[model samples]
Target: MKDILVRSLTGVVFIALIIVGLTWNVWSAIAVMGLFVGLGLAEFYRIFQKENEGPERFTGITGGVLLFSGLCLTWLSWADQRIIWIPAVLGALPFVVMITELFRSKNNPIQNVSLSLFSWFYIVLPLFVLILLRGKANFPFEAIFPIGMLLIVWTNDTFAFLSGKFFGKTPLFPRLSPKKTWEGTVGGLLFSLLAGYLISYFSGLDLTFWLIAALIVAPAAIIGDLFESMMKRSLNIKDSGNILPGHGGILDRFDATFFAAPLFLILHFIYF
Candidate 1:
């Protein structure tokens, strides 16, 4: 009972922070998302923690921040689109990875270097996509893009659990996640789709657009959760980290966002 209360309260606070970050100004969005990127990268690197075999934390994190900020600049068009700074940072990151491994005299130089590069893609890129989705892409309520995106994901998560608790019979994938059931997955998708279809009534977004988003985001969210579960299982650990008491880590909280972001980016561009 106490654990349930703690989890519920943490979830509420997490949702509240994300909502404020999105609904506030643009810089706040960058700052808040940037903070997530930084911490998430740290946790991700720590997953492979070893003296020399693990990823280069400082270089990897710095590169991630630069990658996120550069993309934001390109999207915001607040600076010269042709700015060479982005190119310079991108060019230097790989060398930083390799050189750091050389100094470490690490046996798994391949593991260290590759993990750093993969971290940028796995963790950094997805978070950056969230920023892209916030573009005022013809939606009357610009806030709705991020808020609605989050709402769909959250609604699915909530309903899925309720459904599974009450009606779960068949396991979704006993290999990766033993607790997940097909009933829960379907319930979550149905609820998310309904929420997306209804969002048009409350916001300026098109019914069809949101419906499609729900379709994509719901299953993608499940996949994200499963993927992270696989990661933890392979790593021989339980939660990603203990950062968000009861909720695990930033990855545990935003796994859905990571998968949903890129697909939403394509959606935003196509609509534009």
Candidate 2:
């Protein structure tokens, strides 16, 4: 009972913060997301460090921050588009990791380098896509699109959990996530579509756009959750970290966002 209460309260607070930050201004959104990127990368690196001393944590974090911040600034027009070259320069980070590993005499240089670069794609890139989504000029209600995306993701997650708890018998993917059921997945999808329609109404976007966004975000979110579950299973741990009291970590909370955001951006461009 107490655990449930804590989880509920934490969820409320988390959603509230996201709403406030996203609606406040572009800078606030960047700051909030930047903080998540930092914390998420730190959590990811910590997991890798447990098995072996991986790449330089400082370099990875710095590179991720620069990439996220640079993208945000350029996307929002706060800075010139040429600033994108900053992230391009930081893209040399993998080589830096390999070179640094050479002096350290670490055994699994391949693994170290791979994990370092992978962290950027797995964690950093998806978060960066949110900036792109926000900054698109044609999208009506810049703030609402990202917020609506989040709401759809949350709707799917919430409904999936509830449905799974009540009527989950057939596993969706037993190998990766034992608790996930086809019933839950379908439930989440339906709820996400409903939520998307509501958001579209509120945001003044065509209902069809939101429906497509829901179609994209719902399954993508499932894949993202399963992918993270696969990672946790491989690492032989439970949660990513203990950052959030009942939610586990930034990764745990935002795993769905990682996959959903990028796809939404692409679809928004192509369809919206």
TM-score of each: 0.93, 0.93
lDDT for each candidate structure: 0.83, 0.85
lDDT of 1 by residue, 220-248 (tens): 88888899999889999888888888889
Model 2: per-residue Cα lDDT at residue 236? 91
- Model 1, residue 253: what's the lDDT? 84
lDDT of 2 at 206: 87
Worst 10 residues of 2 by lDDT: 131-140
The CA lDDT at 42 in model 1 is 87
Determine the backbone clash count of candidate 1: 0
- Candidate 2 local lDDT, 69-153, one digit each (tens): 7666665664566676666766676677778778777777788778878888988888777766666453336778788999999
Error of 2 at 254 (Å): 1.1
- The TM-score between candidate 1 and the true structure equals 0.93
Which ranges of candidate 2 are over 4 A from the true structure? 76-88, 136-140
